[model samples]
Target: MKIRCIAIDDEPWALTLIEKYVKQLPQLELVATFEDAIAGSEFLRKYPVDLLFLDINMPDMNGITLASSLINKPFIVFTTAYKKFAYEGFELEAIDYLLKPFDLDRFQKAVDKVEKAMLAAKLSQKSNDASIFVWSEHQQVKVILSEIMFIESRKDYTCFHLYNKPKLLTLLPLKKTEELLPSQEFVRVHRSYIVPVKEIRKIASRKVVLQSGEELPIGRLYADNVSALVKL
Candidate 1:
């Protein structure tokens, strides 16, 4: 199923970039583009959308205020230059908050998060629930997709942190751990880590901070992804 999205940004170049990215992704259909939040609101009210690529710093109406005014909300993915609003976006229940100047690959990664969530939601609705067969203490444990956060790797052993209770630890290398996790949502952006794309807070030059306020070093090998992400 395609994700119908509408791009809204005050800047012409930013809107154009979003348009270009939308055209390239087969799963994303561009329903419309609006320079102001007012026009976008009218379009959205008349026609429902699956996703919205929103700009936070619009002149007339901020993305946050626009989102708050609506009773019905589609999946929101915020785009902004400032990192200060990252926490607020997440608190507002945005699916993903992407910083400005993002590249195609990073954009793809963001879309991947949305797709994964949608797929999981559909599965839940159909009784075809999503499950992950994970290695746990010399045994395999089945985990619900919604129960996970991130895996903390410890030399040849990895601990899977779930939503409740103590985390599950298993014998697995970082590379092996990376391979086992879902590629769309889980990424090895650091050497000793695999993080959920939706869990990220912001990316500075050398490190990425999680929404939980924990910091992880941006590895040399992963620098390209970081660079590409910031460029977007």
Candidate 2:
């Protein structure tokens, strides 16, 4: 898999040099380049990438601060002239540190490290697919999709009703939780409810009856979604 990347530096020449080095590596694909650290941080939040080449010292926001603020952080490679920040970079478990004026050989070494790290992460993610993990009660809770009967949304938090198990509550938005399940398996009948399509036993004009005899209201906004489910 090609590693999608973005480079951020205050200096125009620094950005150009990283762009050139990224082109030389076939395994890397440069998505965008930014001269401002804050702009780069905003882009990363909107779009997901596999790697980042960041300069340590920049105006507005520094690289380390930006990296720490990311919700879903990617692998980071620190590129700057200062060697004093080397210790701080390693503390964040950065992929590699490249001093300024480095040659092609040094750049290749950094890319090689990213390649190996990405491969390992891919394998680990595959192993984690057996159960989805969400934070609750100050710890991560593993949830099996098949065991989930239905979901009830209470604004910021969601309640998960599982078969023969206590309800699990997590601080996840209803819309965000919907994106985690297979589209065909989970159907949204209301703005605040999501039920497993397989667990639905009956559907009325304004209510959905599940196998457990639990009834949930069908919101007007999602009426069309329930109609489509009936056709299935």
Best by TM-score: 2
lDDT of 1 by residue, 1-232 (tens): 7899998888889899999998899999999999999899878888988899888988889999888777778889999999898888888889998898999988998899899888887855643245668777678888665566666788777877777758878776777767766665666777777777667789876888877777888888988766665565
Superposition error at 76 for model 2 (Å): 0.2
* Predicted structure with the largest lDDT when compared to the true one: 2
Instruction: Give a tens-digit lDDT track for model 2, residues 1-232.
Output: 7899999899899888888888888888999999989889999999989999999988899888988999998999999899999999889989899999778899999999988888877755664464578888999999988788899998679999999999999998888889987787789989899998878999976999999999999999999988998787
Which segments of candidate 1 are over 4 A away from where they belong? 128-232
lDDT for model 2: 0.89
Q: Name model 2 segments beyond 4 Å from true.
A: 129-232
Each candidate structure's TM-score, on Cα atoms with residue i matched to residue i, is 0.55, 0.55
Relative to the true structure, how large is the alpha-carbon lDDT of every model?
A: 0.81, 0.89
Q: Residue 97, candidate 2: how far off, in angstroms?
A: 0.7
